[model samples]
Target: MKSLTLLITLLCFLTFSVFAHPPEGVWKKKLVWKEDWVQIWKTVKKEAWETKWKKVQVPVWKEIQIPVWKEEKVPDWKIVKKPLIEEREVPAWKEDKVQVWKKITKPVWKLIDVPVWKEIQVPVWKDIQVPVWKEIQVPIWKEIQVPYWKEIQVPYWKEIKVPVWKEIQVPIWKDIQVPVWKEVEVPDWKKIWVPEWVKMGIPGEKYLGKDHEGWEYTSHDLWRKKLIWKPVWKKIWRKEKKQEWKTEKKQEWVTKKVEEWKTEKKQEWRTEKKQEWRTEKKQEWITKKVQEWKTEKKQEWKTEKKQEWKQEKKLEWKDEWIQVWKPIKKQIWIKEKREKWVEEKQQIWRIEKKKVWATDKKLIWKDEWKSYQAPIWKEVKVPAWKKVWKPIWEKVWVPNSHGWD
Candidate 1:
């Protein structure tokens, strides 16, 4: 029986050695019973089944901002002067001399005797005497005595005294009492039911220390680029005006005054001085004495009467004119202005606003503030699931207890 136990023990030892963990061999010698060995075996098997999680490198990133600037170009301008021309009319001056003649007259006189007649009145005077009488009125005065007497009377008035009466009045009053009504307010009471609140527990007491405030590994994606700038220049062109001077020989008509001597058939006038006799009859007046008498109011007046006597006499008169020869000269002229419509060819410079087009290309780069996340290398821990062994009591069948059945 000892031999059988030894063999069975050797067999169990070899089986445990084959399945045991390499680090658990030192504890296997101290085990006594099969139950304890089985327990150790299960511990070794659970140690092999449980697995350890590994840590890997992951990328973490953050975002930031940056600022940049750029540049541009502009144009400059200026002004200049130019010349222009136009056509107009101008006047010229000249003078001319001429010859002229005029006519004149002269007078001659001669003395001769002439006979004439006139009518005159002669006055005659005579003395006359007359007597006249006049009458006038005269006044005479005499004295006499007379007497008269008058009498007058005056008036007067008298007044008497009188009396008058007036009336008076009086008033009386009495006291009175009045009653007034007032409103009164009354208070009313009522009963109502109200709900009361009781404190149950403090809010958020269970999760006081469970706040997420730690750093965690995250991934972000971003890109990188570069900004470059280049300078370029463009030429500006415009249409401008330039003045050029030119002269041309031209023929035109001018106005002038011309004097001309022309012979023409005309009548001439002359005067001759000769002796001529003229006869005329003249008259004279001779007055004779004539008397006229008028009687009025026994007085006599004598007057002389006037008479006209005419006498005729023939008288000789002569007028003479001297013969004279005179020379007369006249001048003639022509007044005219010569003109013609003419068209002239000229060159004109015109200033026009013109624009020239050109193309200019330059590389322009602007640095703008950019914000993004970039990836970085870091280590992070993650949770992994593994199978483990648990010790528990279970009922199973054994070979024998103390006696065989």
Candidate 2:
């Protein structure tokens, strides 16, 4: 049994030795840079990290915002030159209208000479020309006269009062309202200035580290970085009042007093001795007032409850927030080294053919790095058709048997 166990152990050891990994095959043991391998998605939707998120629109990164070459607005000669302006006169149309007056004919009575008869009292009727004598009978009509007019003497001009019209020029003065223009301040482009950093790129947080920050050419995935900055949120605190209740008992005293009043009943006229409550309400009214006071106190509690909510909100805000640090990648630095190996150990190889015993045999090439000398190629003459076409293999070099020495 002991021999059998020993044989089984030996067989097991041999089996394990055949399958063991080799210790020395270039080892391939080099510090490889773990690239910043991150697969960015709109959202990590596989698990609890799934949440509503907006896709990073990558803001058309290639929109290389090359600064617009604005043509400097140099004031041109035409713009600076003063233009000629002229004042023109407009002719006004003129027209005149003239008025003329013509004299009108009116009836006029010419009196012939009538001799005055003062003292003789004889009727003085002068008819110096009997052929031209007019009728002496005048139509005399007496009208209702005013008292003042009856007192005046007829046909005599004593002291006379006249109303005279005089031409007067009434000058007019008017008030005029004028519009005013207010001065408004406008920003001057000459005063506008931009910083060099702003001119290079849009304003954002700049990452300063040795490794690749934003863009990497080694990976097909576009690089995205997040900075978890701890925000210093502001704190606000305020105080409110807290109320306490105080109750006192004054030996439960009661006062009794009588008062008289002309208390009119529904139908009977009478006097009533009413008990006057000097301080508090009547027992029934006091009970009702106590209930009202209790209700008002509850209303105060409702107002105080709202104040508590503000404190509750402040407690809710005590939660902390986190900011992520920037991610980076290590640079790959390769160095050239000299190495020696056997013919079978050549890493790179190519397939080639050689002829042996009039048959073609494929062979793998082992090219070694070495110095070479270039020789000028020369062409040998052959048949025209043979130069155009390639000849098939016919024979091979053989030293001992089939051919050449």
On TM-score, the candidate that comes out on top is 1
- The true-versus-predicted C-alpha distance at residue 120 of model 1, in Å, is 77
Best candidate (score: lDDT):
1
| Model 2 CA lDDT for position 143 | 42
- Model 1 residue-pair collision total: 7
Tens digit per residue, CA lDDT, model 1, 129-235: 44433333222122322222223222222121122232333222233333332323334343333444443322111222432332122222222343322223434
Candidate 2 residue runs with Cα over 4 Å from true position: 1-167, 180-182, 186-193, 198-405
lDDT of 2 by residue, 379-403 (tens): 3333222112111232212112222
lDDT of 1: 0.33
Q: Which ten residues in a row are the worst by lDDT in model 1? A: 38-47
lDDT of each: 0.33, 0.29
